[model samples]
Target: MSDYLSNPLELFSVAGKVAVVTGASGAFGEVAAEVLAAAGAKLVLAAGKKAELAAIAEKCRARGAEVAEVNVRPTSEAVCDELVRTAVATFGRVDILVVASGKNDVAKIVDMAPERFLDVMDANVTQSWLVARAFTKQLLAQGGGGKIVLMSSARGLLGHPAGYTAYCASKSAVDGITKALGCELGTQGITVNAIAPTVFRSPLTAWMFEENDNATAVRKGFLGRVPVGRLGEPQDLAGPLLFLASAASDFYTGHVLYADGGYTAG
Candidate 1:
């Protein structure tokens, strides 16, 4: 056997790598951390809730990966800077960063309060930008390339049928940010990408399933419209996240990958 072929296991591996995931206490963030751990990454779990972050860190530890936790609003530039410091201090380097903290509130543009609109924008877009900037800076300073993953949604691509003016605006802003930054930083070897998921079971989507009538209608609507006849799970984020974290997507940047159940096709 050739020496190169003998090391085939090196590809698709994250051994000795460190990843920082924001919103690690949330369903999606927790799954992302666990999956990365399974793939051989030390994890730095960032979230606003202290208790929940600790819990998830323990879970990642149980999976045979090192883990640390940081509490931050995620939207604040100062907080994002601190998160990078925390990750570097924990593992000595940050190989990947996932900006996954987000919120969805119903606020029609005509009737929405200014503060509410600002809240959605700050949480969904501004925070992602802050995190991305801080991590990219760290990577440059460390003299190594890095991967950045932004959490966007299908709503960012299409208009909402109901009242989602603020949420939609925030997500669309994220798509723009991802593309713009990816172009600016591509030459620096920092690949930026966004994941657009369909209706997934999370706190952001809980309202759609509330009340039997609303829930049934939403389910049926998705079933009829989407080619894939099922809702997405937290694990749905695993593979794409890994690809972005690894060398597989080295030539890719500024792309919006739809992890939807073909919801965007029609």
Candidate 2:
């Protein structure tokens, strides 16, 4: 047996692999890129903001990872195709893909506008599908097994009393995509999975933990439902991202790994 099979730690090594991370400018994407880079993977980072993508590329480079930055709307199929081509041209191949780009619009069903709901769906669901499809094409062409990690949310699996009509619907769609793709792609040596997280401390969710009466009440209410009694941190997702990106999760597909603090379990 190879050292990787004998030494389990070796299975988690993503050294020398090339990873393409979408939503690289977002809070979760930034952390995911850092974790992959820290594991010795070369990175192709994509986001709608050029400046933010550039900044993230710099950080990854500082970690000794060869990095490329792509500024493109991941929702565009043409743009997503270009992203895959760019990764291949820069790093020779794409071994892993992380679709961390998403959007959430909080509005009650009665108050939500149809356009806004569709926009949320386009951003969270359609964009992810386009990006994943683009990369999967490259992986199939290259004839090697690959890894795809989609970002789902705890909201995808469970509904909330709060205004979450658009957000919840979009993410639920993402969960379906993950499972369907995982089943369809398994035969090609590709594994598709998702990470579903509960309320985490990201820039997008910072308000909930801020110092204020409402924030305090929100925190208390959220924590009451969580068995772990604590919100998630960016670093908390690093290990999970690495595991799904590496060979450690070779046999796992069509799986939604919840990183929630027992919120889903409860």
Candidate 3:
């Protein structure tokens, strides 16, 4: 108990820990890598974009983090297993995993092809499971607690007017996986949780942050529902990512921490 009271900040320290972040080139993934790197964790960054992955790797290296870049995506069991193996090979073990690899294909259900919906599910749901499975296996073999942070969205819980059937369905599945795996791994000292964010500052949504008419109109409507009265910034995710990735969130599992600025509360 004294350990909890003394140096509370120490609970958030991930220094010297090994972290594997998929989709390291994506918005949330980039922030995850940056946070882990700045906090002193060795990083294994995986993404399909070679150049972007290398850029992120260099950025982490600039922060004095030992980084291993893997030009791959968690599209298959073998690839996901390779991510875990690479982490273990480079850092001897993985203490944290951030499944940030996912995509959203917006189209009305009637207009969307079956293949498109399946693609979203494969990216957002199946890949999350694959990476978690691989990471859990490694954690069990190593005999220690680990953290798995899966990316979800407000869309998981709320519906959007603009063609989000595929995205919504996929994220809901991710939420389910988080809960199931969290319970499954609780006894093993491993915790599985997810960060479900609303619209935040990212390349895909950058236009909404602009000063144009369309941007202003969209922002106005979106902000009407957000009690915080603003969209999320990348910095908004830094704290949650750090919390879930560190000892601070040890008691939290099978949970979805929404970083949506109260967008879903109403």
Name model 1 segments beyond 4 Å from true.
Answer: 1-9, 203-214
Q: In candidate 2, what are the lDDT values of residues 1-266, reduced to their tens digit?
A: 46665688989999999999999999889999999988999999999899999999999999999998888779788999999999999989999999989888888889988999999999999999999999999999999599999999999989888788888888899999999999999999999999999888888799987999999998998899999888999987998899999988999998999999898997
| Number of the predicted model whose lDDT against the real structure is largest | 3
Rank by TM-score (best first):
3, 2, 1
For model 3, name the residue pairs that clash.
none
- Which has the greatest TM-score? 3
TM-scores for all candidates? 0.92, 0.97, 0.99
lDDT value for model 3: 0.95
Q: lDDT of candidate 2 vs native? A: 0.92
Q: Per-residue lDDT of 1-266 in model 1, one digit per residue for the tens?
A: 23547665565577788898998888778878899988889888888999988888888899899888777767677888888998888789988888888887885678878899888888898888888889988999988588898989899989986779888889899999989989998888989998888877777678766769878897887778788787887777888888888877878999889989888998
Model 1 scores a C-alpha lDDT of: 0.85
Clashing pairs in 2: none
TM-score of model number 1: 0.92
Error of 2 at 99 (Å): 0.4
